[model samples]
Target chain A: MIRTLLATIALALWQTAALAQTNHQHVSGSACGEAVLRCASKVTPAFAPDGTLWLAWLAGGQVSVASSKDGGQTLSAPVAVTKLPLNLDTGPDARPKIAIDRNGGIAVAFAIFKDKAFNGQVFATRSADGGKSFAEPRPITSSSESQRFETIGVDADGSVFAAWLDKRNRIRAQQSGRKYEGAGLFFASSKDGGATYAEARLASDNTCECCRLGLAFAGPGRPVVVFRNIFEGGVRDHAVVSFADPATAGEVRRVSNDDWRIAACPHHGPSLSISAAGTYHVTWYSNGKARKGLFYARSQDEGRTFSEPLALGRPDRNPARPYVLAGPRGTVMVWKEFDGERTAVNVTISHDEGRSWTKPVAVATTKDTSDHPLLVSDGHKAYLSWMTKADGYRLVPVGDEP
Target chain B: MKRRLLAAIFLLGSLVAAPGADTTSDFKLKPFGRGSWQEVLRAHAGRPTLVHFWGATCGPCKVELPLLGKFMKEHAGIEVVTISADLVPDLPGATRAMLEKAGLRPAENWIFSDGFVERLRFEIDPTWQGDIPRTLLIERDGTITTIEGSAEIPVLEQWSTRQRAAPK
Candidate 1:
């Protein structure tokens, strides 16, 4: 009897501790002070198979995942995915990504800063019990060199794929006294519901080092990735690579010929989504002679060729960080633009398979510091997720203008 | 209430004098072999100097390079120093190649050493938030005028003329 009573007391103390640490603020415009800069900056949202909204962010050295069943009207208490001390890279393009499988499996991937020299390691964690707890984090890359700017996607068959910019080849070339222009795109896949992962493989070399990679599903078990590629003479263009299986990568096709030849990281990445008609809708930012500002195009023949680029946003406005989401309803593109005074979150919808788009509409405005807008969809409706100092965090449905 | 009013006046006075009090001496920067930031300031102590911060990955920075080269060539009285905001780990070859391609080889160049980028940015200018292609015009008397974007040629020429004609 005494042993049972002691166990009950221990359980009670644990519950009290958890309650004290849980976050209860679910409303918009909540204040996130300067101490939690990472949380405020990189808020990524995902939708589960059951239409439940899940949001993930970095706060106080831990990755927190929160769920909302009422279409993000209210959020449940956040659960920590990793308990260990972590130095997360929470830059605009290097935030943690969340992807949920059909079986309620939760996967989160992020880069851990290894040292003061900006070297980082990519790690992923999964929870099989619906976010009650998470398994130990697994390293996706084994190299000591920097591996960061990760993207995660979940296939319909409950498989998880994580891709990142890896610098192992660059390090090896430097050691051998050879010139390496840029890093390589490497990815690892888990087929058995995050239980085990295959060996990491390189998709392509000479990829721009600092931009985030985009990953989306072309079909069941088929994942496509797009990233900035470094061509001959440092021309940074966008390339698409599709894989039938996670381990084998197909040919890398150049998608955008912006000819933005620069040696520095723009911190801007492209967005890709496959429509129901097997066409790819891509949007990106480039100030090249081919097309300037934000541009959009579609490929009907599996990225072998693309339509002529259609420019969006005004020439005077600095439009950047475009994100595209294609669903059964249509394709929606959201981007941030800075008019001379304030920044506005603009959106345009294309109903006829990206052939034409409605005029751009400004949905949100903020003069304070804010994050790049992200889109999360339930396969029928797309919602914009943005966090700003004036507006806190909001999940506004695309058509439900306020 | 009287004491509070006096304190507010004192605060206003300090706010007005703050810019003159702050100088390059408050910062400790690594020398890039061209010279230390302080040495460059001291050498051109009584002349107008243009300090431009750029990075190899920045697209606009590359676009502005030829313009900056033209500005440097046209204006002989103003000192121009271009600093690469790329991290210490990034290879300097790419930056050198960009400079060569833009015909900006004659400009004095520098790159940031490996350190906390925010702290370094704060040391350079307390209000700066580490934006690239940032241009600053430091007058002969240590007054600093900061521009968050690319410098316009007309504005640069006007500032240079004003600084050169200002009584020291």
Candidate 2:
């Protein structure tokens, strides 16, 4: 009986090894020709709070979203989430984003291209039935056009927060939808599952444009937004603010004081991941005159303040587009490094809070092509998604070992 | 008669003094102006005009434009042009000079002259919020056939070769 049990155990182990080496289908049919525009700025995929993957990309001058259930294996046909007409002037690299509610509903948002200018407007669509179908996209800001850099976040209670860098009331009046806004962060919310949103509120002001806005839910209905702020003398630094109800009211606060100074837009932004105990881990890219590095900081008391940012990458190669996600095992941070003509994705892991980090591993390779990578983690298994040099995309799974 | 002659001379002189008179009207392409976008598009009306909008600062556009030059040369009877939207003032006496250095000189070249920028915006797609190195393939009937931010050599070559072989 003991011999027979040993043989069965060996057989099981062999099966497990075989499955791990199994190759995952990396590329599907290319969205080429008129269906998908040819550009460096392409699709960005994220997982819904319900483990279903969602992809958002620009197609035919409009933003679109598609869903996948089998862990990025197969995708549903893309659906037009932006109701804006085909002639609406949308810009490149301003991808649409989606966040999932506690009940598994989804909220999607992106900017609009208008009037010989990218008069950036934020629009949101909701899927109450867990993405079976999405409700029509509705405008979240006033009709008076302004340049906006918008992002969305949903909490456990289904409250939604959409934040953007608004420039309607700035003194200098920067170019709409092109340059960094010289104003504060504006927000609108939906408590009834994104069916209706509150009037726009000023969360914070004096934020940079070109930098992306990030949002992470702290608790039942409270969420926080992290973005690069433009301080005095055109310094670009990272900042965070919280929403008391997130569904209503204008409760926003700045969380950090890096004070990095620069004259040009970095085209990089901050990313956030919230722990179960409401700890906020924010990572951003900074290259001031004094120093330049990828910095990471954490806030234990719900983003009241943050620890000093720990620089991860080397000085010679500045990392771009750093993404952080707090998984069940630990916090995962991923970024891309440009090496002359090639680009590579790097991932660093931390297990004991943000105290320590693992050796960074390369996830994807870009051999002489502009590869814009995006990452999404479902609190357990993290996936790295990026466009390849040959007009393709990849999804790399970084799961903790047993 | 003498007074009328003076008035006509004054009128012609004023028309020359008007801004954009040289470019906005009767802006013909010269022999040295190889790959001029306007002349090529006007000559090849009703056929697809493959325009490669390039810039000196853009790396991708640099590589893509040379391949386009060779491709246009190889495929006879195919009309292709490149618009060099280089800042005219920044490269004083250097606009045509740099085209030679960059090897972008083909049969018809058009450096977006002063005042032509606004006119092209209205002529083509008004909704075109200007992005650099933009590639536009307009069909024969003046309708935009394909519009994109960038193009690869293989894809463009294949598409143009196929169209060249197709029946008119």
Candidate 3:
């Protein structure tokens, strides 16, 4: 709350005067210059049934997709999901989402800013014939004040479940002169790959609106989601919800109590993965007085009880954007750390569920801007998918190949 | 021809000259990077300033920014500078509109450059974890008070009172 500025003052003369310029084109060359996979600034990966890796990425103001036959060494030509460029939502948690169901169906979801007030709208499109083409993109829900941070997951029966933070209830409260806190968690399902969606329904209210929701399927029909929820007194903590089906919203279960109270957005979210051992593994960033920095925890009693939070990453390096995946080689976690020179993507592998983890290792490093590290598994192995400016798109396989 | 030559030279030199801020022209937002932090701080050096960080995606910042503009107006001695930490596409227009709505002009308006934002953030203060609505109250003697979330008016008022009480 109170700190002196001696260091900044010592460094005051280092940075010279800036011009009356607002042009960022020449100064900010961290972004690759095209709408292709190599030029992508943000990338999300999903593995197909046949071990093919499909990636949806945002680049040059366009959402494009490409497939890799052999473990991301090379990618097929990019295919545009939207014909014309749109005002994409490339915020901290906002990016293009992809889900590949069994029988090779591809579904994609992304958000775009609708107005200057920052009201957002989520769009969904699909490809029936592999990645050859895509249908026209449409809003995920009709009644939208602002819908963002949309997440899509595929069930075993090839159905896709979509969940997002929506502000429709906030608008309703505004009209009725009732005060509203945060946004609501809303969801829908596409039984026929994402060509069309069922009616959107409210899953939970007062969920933190700015962060992304962690999504994974429990069984064939059930979907589990972890999100930053707005508890009483404006405490934004992590919570998990299990759905009986696409339409039935389950009880909101508290994941952990970090007691972070703020009236603003974290931009940082949470990640969830359900192991074959049926253990629920989650990781997130929190600044609560009870805990700080990145942490990981697991639940084996069907979201009933969780182990003590296992803090991840070093304190001095400033660990952030932790992603966890329960895969063939147990649970894999990855995050980004800066060393005052280069930002490195570090990984830790746990062979015995979440009981313990291997020493964290830096699998990739870049000296410039980068995207959050995301983990994807191909039913056989887990892979780290990251996009960086110094290096291009990286798809390094983490953990051992089982 | 000589007059046109002089005008071109003047325009070229202005590019490197100080961030001759012009909020009237839709916000003269300079591209802020790691190397530009010193320059930004130098602009408000020796003056009691309130440096606030915000972004387009942050909802709470939208509500607090207009009030901050009013606070600066009410306190004529203290200066308020806002730096946009947005990394989104099509940002300049939106940022300008936000400043106009908040009435935070004639004050320095800076935007995060397109480099690795972590570097830019680290340069400002290595400990900042990129939290929005974060502000720093700089006294005339260069003492800084860091506010994590929104800045409380009482805190700002205390800083103002301290500055007023300090030796001129």
Candidate 4:
């Protein structure tokens, strides 16, 4: 009577290189292939000062970057960031981050899993001679137990600011027999336009272990970072920290109280943008009792206080992975909505610095799996950078509502 | 007496290959695709089943998995199944190795075959927003009790004990 048929059981830490799988994604009629732009798991786009759109994508265990002059209509030949195929971190929240400085310097950062336990090492590479070639990628931190969900932002002075979720503190606590709730947030800045980075510094400890971080800039040396923070009761809610300067870690302030208290991974992280009016607009997904889906909030008082949480999409449709950007024309946010069959990328805009908004609309729709919808702008116009399996890469101009 | 001797030898032979070591051949890593959920339910139609979902990168899962194996050794009557949320052809060796190290012999293991993780996750549970260390327990009548986050061993043991004591 104890005969039970268990179905799918996966445990961790099996040592086998012989049967290690290399083919994760299938080639789609020459379109669903690997190691190319179209077959990327996640794609990130950044606009250069000269309006050249730069994209970095992870595919076939390698990171590649390409530039588009016509606003993603056509691209230059791709340059490989990683020489060898690595155990790249392919988490849903994982993506290569790219930033362009004022002098057209390209700085790229992405992560690779170092061990079977899913520990990650983030690598940074820079292109000084435009898009011709990139330097050898190096680890951002000297001590590398784990680092992930790294984000890159170009400060007003054209220096690169990098922030990521770090686990060095967790390892230290475990060694000292102290209980650490979650990972910590660490940051670094490159005064030399990302050629060489300064020493990595801790912004805050006990940050959420997983999920991505949202990075923005306030002024020349000021960088603002937003991520999931573990509260006193183990409630992993979102928080924002504004750096006084590149070296100083600012106070950790609650973005909103969704009260998502769980010891598991949400995979879904928050998105942030700082308007010219000095308002902090953030969007994140929470399954807490107070909030059950995607929500957007804005804080006019720096990162100190936020507005009431505004729900995003219909609960039945499953809105996820929202991205917010404050562009020159206006502020735009995009997220994915799955209605069982087709998945649509929806967009909402605010012309008055997030004080009001337009209704969310399906800017792009695909019947197949797609990367998270992201927005990129060139001061004059904003566009949606969406990559899908069925369709190739899409860069659609969303118009300037401002 | 001869049959009992062969069975005993076979059991010993399997145990010799099951501890502290694992290769792909040591365990079966099947495909848990879009429609495999229903097939799994049907396979254990009238029996109690435990299906676990984990990923190699999941921190809490690494802690909970080995403990689950120890629990399985104590309760031989309950079936334990696991599915990896991580895409196959990745670093899936750790999952197989961990399963073996935990002494979860005779385990039914599956991996996410499709690259579209969201759709696959939706099939298992629409409410699940891709959290690891999650589990689902199905009773004889196909009533599923979901244990979100890392499962508690005592809760699982009590549930299994309760099922055995229930009238069939």
Candidate 5:
């Protein structure tokens, strides 16, 4: 009898240890409520200048930042970037964006709910001491009109650029008894790190309001932004705007001719990366007549024109949310595909500046709902960050294991 | 002491084995200015009802709203209720203004409350993926037909004709 009892106790102890190990490997930080858990799924990863991986996610009305020194194998405890009451809009196209400056300065921009109206204001916060602490958030847009779906980036000169969907024009048009076809794309920049921002300037008007904006540095202080623009006849094509001076309105150029003239929200946006040879690599989703799936294209003359759109993924699979990252050796594109019963995160790599791409490799699969896969690079190595109902959150290195 | 330990284990096991809270049937939709879906459905319980889900930012919704509005005005016996699926806490005014511009401001217009959107969506249709500009036609006998994309006029007209021919 004593021998049987001892065996039973040993088995129980072994199971307890295994359970603890599993939980520690998956769950990060404290447990959140169900609503916050869903809200916390949308994550953005950034690589600091010193090769530190920084991830920002929304949890329980706060924007939290966690750093992983060992290439995302282990993460430090999350530090609150802002403690104010935040109405975080978390989804495939809406989440908090983080940018690490060249001098180790950290900046985060997010959308906060207004008091009376169901509108949002773009707010930004910065940290000088790495990600240890953050300063008070300041409104990026001066006007009280609705502003959301912001994307932030830092240039080589430490200048912070933020572009978002602005509704000031819509409100003004309403006052004038005219219809503003869609929201306007506006931007603001901070020269001396993230201390203060200049007045917002309009990049373009009639932009699709629901899709996220993509921003990448083209030159020293010039940052290029890509968004869905509402062209004539309501064609929702992609437009590129290069802000040579953030205080002034720059020229807006149409990059893709995939005239996707639809009257619906795809909820998918474009991703951009500048190669070492000064070529701009962009990937976006569209069901146009010419291009019918996720596509990749490159512009050699800085968004003036683009190459032929190359379709990615299989024809039968429904792929959405494509993300691109340009490393020193190659460019990687990651997207999610849903095949009726299962969802898979797939990746395709290009070594010749997106002129050609390899066959897509499925990195992860889940039978439940999952967030869009994100790609972040440290100029040498590219990593994929994903969150799912089955695996919680994972930051895995892509293209490192052959 | 052994018996107490066994009892404690039994209680813990029962607590863990119990099912989660039932949130599927919580169908309380708030009023959007005046009317709610519940009241509209109850008033026309025996008649066919059409529920249209739309968002202000959706491009396809812009094209479909006017068509739906015209259909509603032309058809008399069919009950049409439009619901704005805009992120409840972010853009209700925009949605309302857009609907007004599109002439889709029906008397039974409504918007989902902030948060719990997934739960409410599941309650509406378990298989729905929350796509915008979706249409649903409910027959008099409680049969529901959900169309993901925009519904054509002929589809609605046929459904309306069948609904009228059914027994009251």
Candidate 6:
């Protein structure tokens, strides 16, 4: 009888294993709830010039900043930088990005969604005393109209640059500053650590209606901003706009000649990272026949010229929403690979700058629910944060194995 | 034959009601009681298990309970196990009251043992990070057919039908 019972158990286990093999892939961890934006999942870790870690995430719809003064072993309680008002959007705000200047001051920036749209202004609060406390949030723009899809970057000299998909250029005035309502990419800068700002300037006359703008600091005093550049022919291609200094201003330059022509907006925009050696590395997804998979382009002379683009993912992989982090010796690129009905996160490392990269490694196997895997590097240690159906946003340390 | 079936029901009921009854899946989960979950899984192995993880303070859970009770009643064969993920020991009484308000029968309940979140997540699937209100369906062969969140009755019935029709 005992032998028979053991046989039954073995049979049951085998049957389960076989059945699971069909629709299920053995994942590294068990799955949990559907994809959501929970309080604990937001992650934004920026390395100071001296290697101090400043991580920021959104908690209960408010922006929270935490500092790990001694590496990442311990993190301080998240202090709120954005005052999430009562009338703010119902769901938790998107994850906030943090940038640390040479002097150790941190500027955390995030956009608030209202009425099922990105209506809230992008705001940033600075911490002068190593992130122990944050100053009051001063609005990047005080316009009551919707100013959505905004991204911010702070230079080593304390100059701050903020860019977004602006809709202010149409013949007929649009409501809520939405891109579909006659929008283009616009930027604003603050000369003194987010204290005072200049008037918003239209960086690129071309832009996509649905994609968010990506802005990053190319060097100590320079800035490189990339967004979906809308052209005269309505061919929406990734455009790179740069400035020697935020105060002096510069014209936006269309980076690549992919000329992806699609009637509808793809919603996937380019992610740019500036390396320590002053190279602006960018990666984005385009489905135009000639240039399909994920593409990597870099500018050796700051923002002037980009090398021939390199495909990062497999030929058939629909790579979308690329997030790039330029490390000491390499650039880490994370993107979602759309495999038919399912989706998974892929990571690649570039050792010879953007010229070549390691074969893509599948990090997290997720469903169609995950979005925009954000890359954060503290120089030496790089981390990838992405939203999962079960856990809102999870942070995993990258490049630990090889 | 009908009498035999009734007799078997009574025998199983007595077996389940004996002083210890099969107090296994229904009572507060302990490490020892966890073995009973296997029995529960075996009993309902052919059917889908809707494991509703809820706390007393969750307003949304409260709003959805009546709907769940109706769903349980409508889907006769499916096993609807509502496990309280709450830490409070007094939760059992409050949970029972909430279920009573929703007109839930006594057969559809269990309180997760302490530290269940850590153990159960891995035990269910190594890839699972902890998230509550997690519903998983275990096939007769011990295969997990579908895993998702807060599925309503029709969807549960659809999954059940799909599981039954799937090739062995």
- What docking grade does candidate 3 earn? acceptable
lDDT of 3 at A35: 70
Taking the candidates in order, what DockQ does each have? 0.05, 0.02, 0.23, 0.18, 0.09, 0.02
lDDT of 4 by residue, A271-331 (tens): 9988888889899999886888899999988888898988888787788889898887788
- Of all true interface contacts, what fraction is found in model 2? 0.00
Q: Candidate 4 residues B23-95, lDDT tens each? A: 6564668877778888888887888889998877787878888888888778777788888885323445667
TM-score result, candidate 1: 0.71
Tens-place lDDT digits, model 2, residues A34-64: 3232321356776766677777765444556
Backbone collisions counted per model = 4, 16, 0, 14, 5, 14
Give the Cα error of residue A195 in candidate 4, in Å.
Answer: 2.3
- Point out where model 3 deviates above 4 Å: A1-30, B1-26
lDDT of 6 by residue, B1-168 (tens): 667655654543443222111222343322212344565676676555666655443323565678778877776655777666542222344465666667664445766553223334334443332223355666556766543334466766787687557765
DockQ of 1: 0.05
What TM-score quantifies how close candidate 2 is to the native fold? Answer: 0.62
TM-score for chain B of each model, two decimals: 0.73, 0.62, 0.80, 0.81, 0.73, 0.62
- Chain B TM-score (model 2 vs. true structure): 0.62
Which DockQ-derived CAPRI band holds candidate 1?
incorrect
Order the candidate numbers by lDDT, best to worst: 3, 4, 5, 1, 2, 6
Query: Which clashing pairs does model 3 show?
Result: none
Question: A33-140, model 3: which lDDT tens digit per residue?
Answer: 567776677899999999999999877657899999988888898899976545567787888999987888899999876544667878888998898899877777
> Rank by DockQ, descending?
3, 4, 5, 1, 2, 6
Query: How would you encode candidate 5's per-residue C-alpha lDDT over A305-344 as one tens digit per residue?
Result: 8998888877666677799888765888999776655778
Q: What DockQ was computed for model 5?
A: 0.09
* A151 Cα displacement, candidate 3 (Å): 0.3
lDDT of 5 at A66: 83
- How well does candidate 6 reproduce the true complex, by DockQ? 0.02
